[model samples]
Target: MRLKFQFGSFITFIGFILSSLIVTLDLEAQTHQFKLIDEETNRPIPDANFFYGNEQGISSESGDITINFQPTITLTISHLQYGKRSFTAEELDQALKKHQLALQPKSHNLQPVTFISIHPNAGEQEQMTLQVQDKLAHDAGQVLEQFSSISSIRKSGAYGFDPVLRGFKYDQINLVIDGSQCATAACPNRMDPASSQVPLNMIVEAEVMKGPYSLRYGNAFGGTINFKSADPSFTDKANLNGRMGTSFETNGEISRSEALLGITSKHADIKLFGSLSTGNDYTDGDGVKIPANFYRSNIGGKIGLKLNSTQTMSLQVSNNYGKDVDFPALPMDLRKDDTWLINLGHKAVFYRGALSSWSTTMYATKVDHLMDNADKELNPRMVDANTSAKTNNAGGRTELRFDFDDDWLYAGTDMRIENADGTRKRNMLMGPMAGKTLTDNVWQDARIRKNGLFAEYHSQGDNFHLVFSGRLELNHAEAQNPDAGFAANYTDMSSDIVSPALSIGGTRTVTDNFSIGLWLGSAQRSGSLAERYINYFPIGLDPYEMIGNPELKPETNNQADLIFNYKSDATDLNLNLFSSFLNNHISSEIRKDLSPKMATAPGVRQFVNVDKAKIMGFEASWKQIINRKIQQVAELAYTHGQNTTSDEALPEIPPMEFRYRLIGSFINKKLRTELNFRHAFEQNRIAKSYGETKTPAFNVLDIKASYLIVQNLNVAASLQNIFDEAYYEHLSRSVRNAESRPIYSPGRSFYFSLSYRF
Candidate 1:
């Protein structure tokens, strides 16, 4: 609740006249460090790890490190004794003018592409880099709604949202891309999620794996996300590159653009990309508006090959589209959506031994959805509903990784095939069913086929590091046509599930800088496709008309976690605590012998099997550098869900949140600035029989800057919410006649961007 200071001084004077119309005149360059050498004993090597897009930094034992240039600053170094590479910045700016830079010590240590196990192996790994240099993120749930612990599910006005970890969400989390889990959400109130169909400038990284540790990648009960994009490399001559960017904002005049291209040779590689975005309807620091409109687009391509030198292969394709999207708290309005994706992959490595690497991936997805209420507003028993949906998925995975002496083993096999069918139509257009016409079949051909087998084992020492994981699955669901009110209220819709999963975690060093970690897990999830063939369909959440419970029964998450850490040189910290204990907990119940077909529905609900439930959480993170021109980051999160056999509470839980950021690096780092703040605190443990609503606290502020208009171009600006905060975010959504109104955010905006790379 902060606004009107002349609307934050007219959005800080329109972000200072759009940063003086795209600023100019300021060219400084000071920040240093870019040294790492050891090409055959050239010395200085220590700790290594570098990256640009996903922004990582390390290298200090004398090997320097510090990067923030851009011109497509591609980095990606990594080194244990030299084992990864990718350079650019004009091949390291002449070794940063002799500031070192040299590496090449891989007689054959092969294995890259994270065939599996590389991230905390499964116990608490969080890597997010979806553009967050102080505000301006369009999708991927606005970059996990700003990291730490995470929560999102704002049912659109800005784009699908979704993502909710800790308390889990939809299919209990598992969003893969690049190892493709083929985009899955074709509206059923999910308005097309799959992290909003990629395209956040084609994401270059996103990783999270918090609870159910890992089981290769299947039945993840509540954690797993891996989104990576853009992988191109080559040398030995022959190259061509490209990139382009665009952005603009001022409360709903949103627009974005993207482009990229690549070509390499020495074996082969190719890439292409495209993007587009648009928005409108925004004005809410008490100035109303808020219908939230959208249009999106994306295109893609990829190719690679290098058949010798330890095998490799790749292929990719993509398509994403959306139009006129909007969901005023859900009731149809998304007029179109189309998604298509494909993936293929292969790799082999030998390093030396009985088995070292093997990987394979294949995928496919398709979605076509349409929704309508003819854009809301109009009613008097005047029917006009419409909905058309589609979803299809295909999957694959193959793995084998092994090494001994220090330990590592992994094996896998995966499969999936899903299909959901839909249709709905109505058209009364006037009184007493005037000129009636109705139809149904909201998913009458549901199907699910799965098969899995996984394994993992790892070990390390010098302090500790361990892992072990497992998975076993065989699910088969079928509705295969059943829509006559779902075969007269249920006749055993056929299911055959067998799930199992396990995980173990480790990390311990309790000294030389503190460290400790632990994890335990169990997972299972079944019952989807609308909990087993939705038929009455109102998609639950109070207006109630849902039904679908083909003998439901599979929901388990017996998790645990604990962690603590601390680092040096600038600062880095962590603290986590988590819990999950649920069993056969799939909610919804109430079917007073069914009787409520939409006249503003009020009875009828199905999909049961609720025995016990629980969820608990905590998170804290910090990063600091307070010296060379300030820097800091902070985070805190919370969760608490429950349903202890109906003692209630738990339906879109999300309340405690905190964030902070502050950065500045002027005249030497080529100018950079940031300040971010966020808070959320009021939310009365909702779920009042699921019409949940109690939000009230919020605070936001943002400011940004960027320069660098040379070394390949850059420009940025921001003012987002600088005191204009009408807020509402506690798992948003309300207003069916306004139940304490929610879903409001976006005011005092001004953002700008420009990018280029060679």
Candidate 2:
């Protein structure tokens, strides 16, 4: 991969933005001492800036501020960790005279832990912040299902539930680890999304942006998922700490073991983490066994150097291995998989001059995937077939931040290069092709290069806050296939495309407990390698093969969002409405005129660019305290999508769904319990041209509880599918082993976990 850089042009652009920072000051000064802290954690907010008119000062390491302010001045405070807030000078003076001021924490939206369980004795407490160890103990090794807005598209009854957001899937969503882009799935069927590469025990925090609001992340059309790893905790003197945990589930006979160790010092810290998980075929409702089994192991470590209090540098590396991974819904099962990832980063904060902070990071990842059909039963004794795919990705970003009196600017540039290639081989065992082997390159030598420059601006005033952002993007892709013959001419192609994205949004506070906000954005997505180069690739759960169209145009999306939020001591509510109009949407179309080779083949579809499409939806979530001892949380989501040009519903779209939880706490907050209910409406809309299938509605209930046996040790138990109902999700794949029946979710099962830290 090659990239062209214009440093001179970028320097001139930065100079122009800097020119706006040199204005004259207007102030009536009176010295005052103040402190800023987070309302939720009561922790000091370092480097928070306080502004009065044109006078500005930043907080010290301990969040202490000594600033001169006018009696009539309106104090505006801002921080990257926290959004923005404004207060009257008199209010601040009163709080300062009394002590520290606690700023109501802004919406973290950083994929914080959302509790879904109910402890019989616990009341009204729906969510609890969990450490790495606690999360591992609570979750059944399912990493991506932690977010409320995200749901998984299960391939089987076992591991690897591909995450789906809103109505978008696959490349539409971007997944980043430690601020670096990750490699795409080596399997055309996407058995291995980026999230599956890291075990839950390795994640320190997960952040999700719902839409294309932040331009810093690459091509964030659907959204961006940032997985932050645990950094070494530092102390005055060097210290060694460690933790170990294990869990088991009765339904699938699943078990997981994890361990973590760390060494921390004032200036340096290092840590290592590892996990091993295994599960057997699970039984669905009616006691029918489901052929879903998998085994996975992962190990990772990070080393950090403080480099003083204002600057830091870190390096991280990880590897994951999988074996006996079976996908009953897909054409092939994973025989083995190996993945490796490495990243290095440097950051500097509290710097002098207009550059309040600057950071740079670099990362690379590689994946080797192999799958075959040796375990499946074939009607006619047939040959053996296997696929070997590999993908590599490397990218880095450098960003600069500037803070002013009432506004801030964030600008950065990032680039990601990806290379993928694979081969499929079929050996004839009993047919005419028996004793002979035929091999074809599925991906060829395909490559994709994406380079982008982005900037975001945020400003605060009396009663409203505004955020504006934009990105300039350029993309290129090419593939080489020699043995494809006519297919080569059809799939061998090159593309160089350029596009721009813009978004502007604002929030107006109706009152202290309620707010209304709106945003409109335009984003573009270039065709992926598999969308442009793959030949006869089975991307779905069925035997349908997909052909790439190299001459495809980039898809464009124009969307609008409206949000209403209300928060109080006893209740919290959020409602969101969104609509998107897409241009040149790419989807599979059955084409019968495929040269002579596949003209009569059933389910052979080719990717085609459609003229128009629309996706609109709404999501509502409510949490209310029924009493001091019990709480309730409910969420509802619905999405409708169609090919406006064809007047048909889109294929593989999820159905309307709702989830509710009843929670309770007891034993002085040491024991908690939750009762959960989930419902999905039947999906009748089908894309007949694309061989779509309809699914029936489902309802399920679950119960869970957790308790602290003693300090540093915890125990949890859960009963899922309490009624043992037979139900399948709308997005579940048609199972091959079950005569094309949709794979049903796991049946009644009991799970228990325990952890102790030392």
Candidate 3:
């Protein structure tokens, strides 16, 4: 069913609000938009500082800003390379009429590595401005892992590189796309995670927050990562534009290609995009072929309509498909997977100055997956095994913001409903039950629904900035059909839970070039469908069949962070020290009293609460612009996690790691070269109880170069794993082979790309 039909009353009320905006007046007299660009190159400049009236804000990617329109007002803008400039009322009026503004360059070259921006959110730590030549990856997770130190990926096979952050993965880390969270994985082994399902070619920007210091984006227990797409824009003149790109890799004989087309008029715009990727198994550093082969295709489009000067509406639709994917880490391989998504959005600036603006987004998505061991050498009793699963999700969020000079108040409501079902067929060719087929319920008609209300307040002063937010949620979960014996073990097959979350953060300027900040937060995360409804399935990091616990309580994370920052004309540096304490942490314990249901797995484990858990970490980042020709970005991060109740180390904590990137510009900024290096320290703190092993240290180097051949055409090339180093991440899962060792990294590989835009 459509999300609108599922949320009948809610959609009706929001629609009424949308209609009522016509009569409402924006008393603030705001609505002027400006795009800041380089005076010499005419390219957009990010992280520019602008001040007007009582508001001082930083420009986002491409230096786009919207402010109150006042003929008598004066605006001041400043940048590291562009220096400072002031625009008088007359100049502002002229710039507004022409719809073009530029700042003079103070140096011969322009370089930007990392900086802070105000909108989007206050807690944003980093932003990756994606480009066609830079983001040549098969999935979104690969694109994210290169952007920040706080982000990592748990590689499963050729397809699923699920995102991990701050020692948390899966449901603990919330990943959203254009304000909607709807990725639902169907495989118990997570062969196709949320990051893999979202079309990577559609993303224009990626941003991340370090911790759960905000409540406006759902129950973010660990942190939040938001993937943003190009907003459909209306131009005064009719325009038709598009971009196409193709890439090739020597290793695994990989090939990838994507294309985008857009048409815009005075009041409407539409965009279409598509991509295809195919690859075979690649040899590792040891000259051994890994089980990594896959084929994927994606198609998507977006539409936008400008109702008036104060209102805009958008709609998006997408489909993704995968086939013949191999997963060496798991017992089953992905035969086929398909996903469909539809999203609707509306925004309006109120009249009469009663409300600054209000926006709403509603989306529906579904994933259908099938996995089996058809290629594997079948065991005697378990000749063949096949499981089919699917997940359906529908959700919406609406927010109303009121601006008051240097402060703003925001109130919003969000809701999500999900349904899951799956069945596994086991074919017997030997043993006592030869030539007989057995059917087992993996997820017997499970459902999870949640409704939430949230509020946020922001205040800014000459030397300090403060942000406060809170959220209240009501969650419901149930299982309609469960195995008879499993049902009898846990009588309560349903639960209704109430969860609350809040956070407060403030930053103080201590001196001319130094600042300090502190953040404290607490969040609650409810159990997932598998955590509460799975039957006898080997779904955990261990090799034990797991049973569900319908009566599981919500987990909580109480966290604090101490931040130090320093900024200068040529460099920006930041350091963060953080700790998290958890209560009611969900864990698995062997259920000796129960008998095994899956023949290959003899042990049975049940989900339970671990009384206490903790994770502590620190991160340091540095960005330096050297002489406007060479810029460098570096990061160092470390994390330690433990099950405090059991006095043991956590299972999947990553080791200390460091990364560095150096960029050099030549030929009037048309040719760019970058060198990348990474080092990971050895990890000896293993969770022996979970059969975890130690990992050795390793280092890798890479180099890339891109050149603009013409006005709108570019060529790029890169060599990865330059040393052909054989290594594996500490968080890598053990493969299904008898050796039980993690998969090795790929050997030296070369890639090339050519792209054009008009």
Which model scores highest in lDDT?
A: 3
Where in model 3 is the C-alpha error above 4 Å? 1-32, 36-72, 76-86, 97-130, 148-155, 351-354, 379-381
Q: Score candidate 3 by TM-score against the native.
A: 0.90
lDDT score for candidate 3 against the true structure: 0.76
lDDT of 2 by residue, 1-758 (tens): 12223223334444543443233333234445555766644445555677767556566434655556567888888763366778897897787674578876553221111322211111122123123223453222255554556777777677667777777777887878766658688988878877677545666556677777767778878777776665434567988877677888898888878887888898898989888888898888977788878888888988999775455678888888888888888767998889898887766653235656666777778999999988877666476788999998877777777877667778988888887889888887885567988887788768787888999987765556678999999998777543355254464477789978898887777776777888888999888878877777778534677777777898888888888887777788888888888899988777676542221125567878999999889888998998877899999988888999999997777888889999887787678888999988899987777666888888999998877676656677889999999988777777765367777888999988886665
Candidate 3 — which pairs collide?
24-351, 25-351, 25-352, 25-353, 26-351, 26-352, 27-353
Better of 1 and 3 by lDDT: 3
**What's the TM-score of every candidate structure?**
0.31, 0.86, 0.90
Please tell me which predicted candidate would have the highest TM-score against the true structure: 3
The ten-residue window of minimal lDDT in model 2 covers 117-126
2 or 3: which has the higher TM-score? 3
TM-score of 1: 0.31
Residue 475 displacement (Å), model 1: 32
lDDT of 1 by residue, 1-758 (tens): 22242134334433432332221222224433455866633445544546567445445433556554566577777652355689887877777666678796532111111111111100101111113231234467666655657678785558888888867887788878754465767677777877887655545556677677777877777887776654434445788876677788889888887776878886788878877778988888999888888988888888887665445677878788888888887767898998888877766544344455566676778889889878776546478888898887876777777656455677877777777788788877676778888888878868777778888886755556678888998888877778766677666778898988888887766665666778888988888788777777776556687877877889898988887777665776777878898998888888798886556667878889889889997888787889988879888888899898888788888888888999877676666788988888997888887778678888998888877656656687789998898887777676455443667878789988876666
